[model samples]
Target: MKTADPALQAMLRERNLRIIMPIASILAALGLWEFLVWYNDVPHYLIPAPSLIAKTLIQDWATLAQSAWFTVKLTLLSLSLAIAGGVLLGMLFALSRTVEISLFPFAVILQVTPVVAIAPLILIYVESTFWALLICAWIVAFFPILSNTAIGLRSADHNLRDMFRLYQATPWQRLRYLLIPSALPYFMAALKIAGGLALIGAVVAEFVAGTAGQNTGLASRILESSFRNEIPRMFAALFLVSVLGIIIFLTTSWLSRAVLGHWHESEIKREL
Candidate 1:
């Protein structure tokens, strides 16, 4: 690779410097937070100090870690199912206008219905808590993937479609060679949006279902912490939730770039 020009290097360094300053500012704010709490002699139960929050994070690390892991599992598993089912259904819709017209209304209904409302019904009908939670999360996360993938599948260039038709490309060949690549950017976009939604869904579902022993997740930990008035522990769980969200966002971004950076406008990197 060509070395960056010195002026460009300096500009890049300055840009990164701009990013670093905000992080420093946040840390400074936290330090100020610790000081103010001390200065006011604030009760820990009311608003825990940063130091106490850190300490509680360490003290209750084991249970918090397990709960975080459970939440992660539900998010991952539900996201996987969402992508699989949505993409398959989207492909069916894409290939046949008849199917799209017939089934799209149902898809819209499912997508529109609030998962909070659905969770209770799912809990009653689904014997296992795990399955119910999965269903709820999947319901919330699947729509974006389905809608975006369907659009992507139909978004192939008209010339390319004509070429495929002229070549008598089989359905599988069209899918493998043309449709999937065309849909990738859309899928990635949907994944980024749905990644956060999946997390929200999992947590919301857990909150509604009360996280029975087998279904324990971060929502349970957060609720339990709040009920017990363990402010620091609540903050710690919240910190973990924020970290999980950041990880998911970053992971999906990286995956989008890796998959579509070479071609798609959505994921392409621009020259400075």
Candidate 2:
């Protein structure tokens, strides 16, 4: 049999380690935490063991699942809105200097202002709690996309731009062929950032809205558990939120790789 190439074997080992290391670390940490808690006879109410949190998650799955679904819906809806608004506004800004100058400060203001500070005011104004939460999440997720897209659109090579102009390319052709491609990498990066922000905003908005009932999200569950001093349940809800965020991140990363892996340096895999 032919010997395996050493470089390929090294690459495979590296890839395996990348996957193994994080999982090993997480398991080790949890084991240590469980041991210390059991050894010290720690109260579950103060810091429940990971196993107890997992048990709470299973026992409360029905209630927790519904709330998780609500949170997922809220996060996705707000992110969708943010993408639509941010892309359109970014394009307009890239195409018009006056528009950028006029509107960018307002975007900055929205980003700098804490969502919690304005969430109460938004709830007071918006008749529907869902809409209010959505607006808050949108505000949190919109700025990064807008800024990145605008910058990316403007980042196309001037030489390529001049060539397009020399060829008398139509506006649509220039946009479709040149501007969009240049902006895609930046936009993908922003998507990862905005995805997490959207979830955080939804949770924070729900915390402020404090809407209770069948339609409420994970944040409401966390708040209720906190109020009742059901620490394990609170931890369970938090664990779900963390998992949801990780899912969003992984999905966005996969999408970025799918879209850019063949051409973009950022996504292309290279042997170490």
Candidate 3:
């Protein structure tokens, strides 16, 4: 039988350690938190132990799950709209200096203006609460994608660009062969950032809307829990929000790796 290579074994060990360490650390931290809360006889209202939070989550899962689904839908819808708008505008900006000069400042202004400040106005004007919330979320998520994509499209290697020009490449040929690949890395990075921002925007919009009902999102659930002084339920809702953000981040990261792992330096793992 052939012996396994020591380097391969070492690499496997390193990969396993990377995964194990974070899980171990989180478990340890939660254990410590639980012990301290128990030892102090802390009121659940002040700081619920992880166990209590978990129990609350289970107890309230029916209501919370519906709210979670609502929040998820809001986030996804806004993100989709942001992506469509940003990429199309980014492409237009890349293709036309006049358009970029005229419109880029407006994008910058929107980005600098706090969403909270405008959300109220949006809510007031938009007839549909859901559409208003989506607009708010889309505004928050759009800029990063537009900025990154524009930069990426412009970042195609000048040497390769010259070669394409020298060969009299068609516009579509140049875009497909050169520009799109260059823009992909930037787009993926922006996606990770925009994913989180979309969730935040959705939550913030929900808070602003403050529409209370069975159709409400997690933010509304949190608000209701706070109003009732149901601290554990509030914590549970907060936990769900955090979990959703983590899920979005992980999903975007996985997409980045799937798309760019083979060729992109940022995604490629180098053996040391």
Candidate 4:
């Protein structure tokens, strides 16, 4: 058998070390969690053991899974709409200083406004809870994308801008070539941020407005479990939500690397 080079072996060892630490950390935390519950003899209602949480999750898999699906659907839908709308608005802002100055204050207002505070009024005005939830999530998710993308669009090299103008590039061409590429990294970063915000918004809205249609989300289930003092089930749902958020964050982060890998400094760090 051919021996691996020392440098390659060292790199492999380092990679494995990096992977092991997080896994070790998680296991240690879970072990500590289990110990605390056992040590305190914590009541099941107060703090369910990890074993109980797993059992509850399995026992209620059907209902929990359905609710999980609903929450995922709402999150995905809201994120899609936010990305589409935010990118367009960001472009508008980047292209016209006056338009940006006029409209940005409202965006800021939307950003600063708490979804919990807004959900009730939105539910009152909007005939359907679904629409209201969508709006609320969009409100929370859109601003980062819009603001980051606007900054990115404006970040294109001034020389390139001058060249485009000299070439008599059409507005669309300028946007497609100069602005879009320049803005992509910022947009992806915004997307990563927005993914978590979208989930939070959906859950918060559901918590406030309750469920509308046949499909109630995990947030509703969480609230229900909390009210009834179903501690294990609550922990299970909360765990799933936490998992979902982590997955979104990691997935977006991966996508950002995949798309901007060739151009961005963040991705290039690995090369050095």
Candidate 5:
């Protein structure tokens, strides 16, 4: 029988290691935490063991699920709005340097300004809790996407642009063929960043809104649990938030790779 390629074996080993290492590390940390808590006879209220957290998560699944769905909806809505606004404005900025010069500073200001500070004012102006939360999340997520997409649109090959100009190409044609293509990688990169920020923004907005009522998001649930001295339930809600964050990251990363895998150096797999 032919011998297996050593390079292939090495690649397979590396892939397994990537999966195994994180799982191992997470288990090790949990074990150490559980052991410390057990040895010290720490009160569950202080920091419930992971086992208790798991049980609480299962027990409170119905309530937590509703909140999780609400949070997910807010995150997705905010991210969608951010993408639409970012791409449109980014395209416009690419078309007109003067517009970019005039408006980019405002975008920078929005980025520098804390959404937490802005959220309270937004709540006063926007009567609807949903819309206020959404706007807060959008503010947090919009800038990275706009900046990256604008940079990408401007970064198209100068030679190709000159050729397009020589060909008397219509502006739309140039944008479709050259600018959008050049911007995809950068947009994808920004998407991954924005996804996490969007989740954070949604949570923070929920926090600002506080535990107003039964039908609310995870942050509200966290507040509700804390006030009632349901520490385990609070930890459970917190775990869900962390899990959602990981999901957003993994989902966005997969999307980026899927979009760029064929040609982009960042996503394309190379031989060991």
Candidate 6:
């Protein structure tokens, strides 16, 4: 059999590094953490070993599962609202320069404002806990989608727009045929970012609202764990949060690849 080309070999090596290195690093860190806890005889309340954290997660699965489900609900709903609002607003702005100029500054202000500072005020006035959390998460997630989609709409091919004008294409025709495809990559990019931000916003809102019992999210569980000095359980809640973030990232990344891999160079196979 013919040998693989040197370039293919290099690509394989790079791909292996990409996959293997991170796993190796995580395992090494976990091993070190476990060893340190064991060697130093550190109490579980101080710094629980990775194994202890895992045990806590397994033992508290019922409570943690409920908390995780609540958090997931918040994240997904906020992201969905952000997507709908952002895309519609972006398209409207793309069509009307005057409207964009007038309304865009307000969007910028919302984006720049810290959600933490605003969350307490929102909770105070919102009247409903769920809506308050949703609003806070929506606020965090909305702007990236809006800005990226707006920029992407504007980034559509000028020459194509002129040709469409010459042919007297309708607004819908222009959007469907020319602009939407151009804006897709930007929209997907924003979606990936918004996913993480939505999770963070939901958790932060939960922390600020500080409600407990059946209606609570993972942040509440974390707070409860901290107050009770259940350090391993706190770590377990944190672990779930990190895992959720990873899942969001992976899901968005896969969505991006699925949509754009065939045509977009960013998603296409690289030579180097």
Query: Model 5, which residues run further than 4 Å from truth?
Result: none
Kindly report which residue pairs in candidate 4 clash with one another.
none
Q: Report the C-alpha lDDT of model 3 over 1-272, residue by residue, as the tens digit.
A: 99999999998999999999999999999999999999999998899999999999999999999999999999999999999999999999999999999999999999999999999999889988888989999999999999999999999999999999999999999999999999999999999999999999999989988964458899999999999989999999999999999999999999999999999999988966
Whole-structure CA lDDT of model 5: 0.95
Candidate 2, residue 62: the lDDT equals 96
Residue-level lDDT for 88 in candidate 4: 89
lDDT tens string, model 5, 1-272? 99999888988999999999999999999999999989999899998999999999999999999999999999999999999999999989988999999999999999999999999999999988999999999999999999999999999999999999999999999989988989999999999999999999999988998987667999998999899999999999999999999999999999999899999999999864
- Scanning candidate 1 in windows of ten residues, the lowest lDDT window is 263-272
Compute each candidate's TM-score over C-alphas: 0.93, 0.96, 0.96, 0.94, 0.95, 0.93
Root-mean-square deviation of Cα positions for candidate 4 versus the true structure, in angstroms:
1.6
* Residue pairs that clash (backbone atoms under 3 angstroms), model 5: none
Model 3 residue pairs with clashes:
none
Give the Cα lDDT of each candidate. Answer: 0.92, 0.96, 0.95, 0.91, 0.95, 0.94
Question: Which pairs of residues collide in model 6?
Answer: none
lDDT of candidate 6 over 1-272, digit per residue (tens) = 99999988988999999999999999999999999999999999999999999999999999999999999999999999999999999988988999899999999888899999999999889898989999999999999999999999989888998999999999889989989999999999999999999999999999998854467889999999998999999999999999999999999999999999999988999654
Model 2 poorest 10 in a row by lDDT: 207-216
lDDT of 1 by residue, 189-246 (tens): 9999999999999999999998477548888988888888888899999989889999
lDDT, candidate 2, 174-224, per-residue tens? 999999999999999999999999999999999999955568999999999
Over all chains combined, what TM-score does candidate 5 have? 0.95
Against the hidden true structure, what lDDT does model 3 obtain?
0.95
The superposed Cα distance between candidate 5 and the true structure at residue 224, in angstroms, equals 1.5
lDDT at residue 227 of model 5 (Cα atoms) = 91
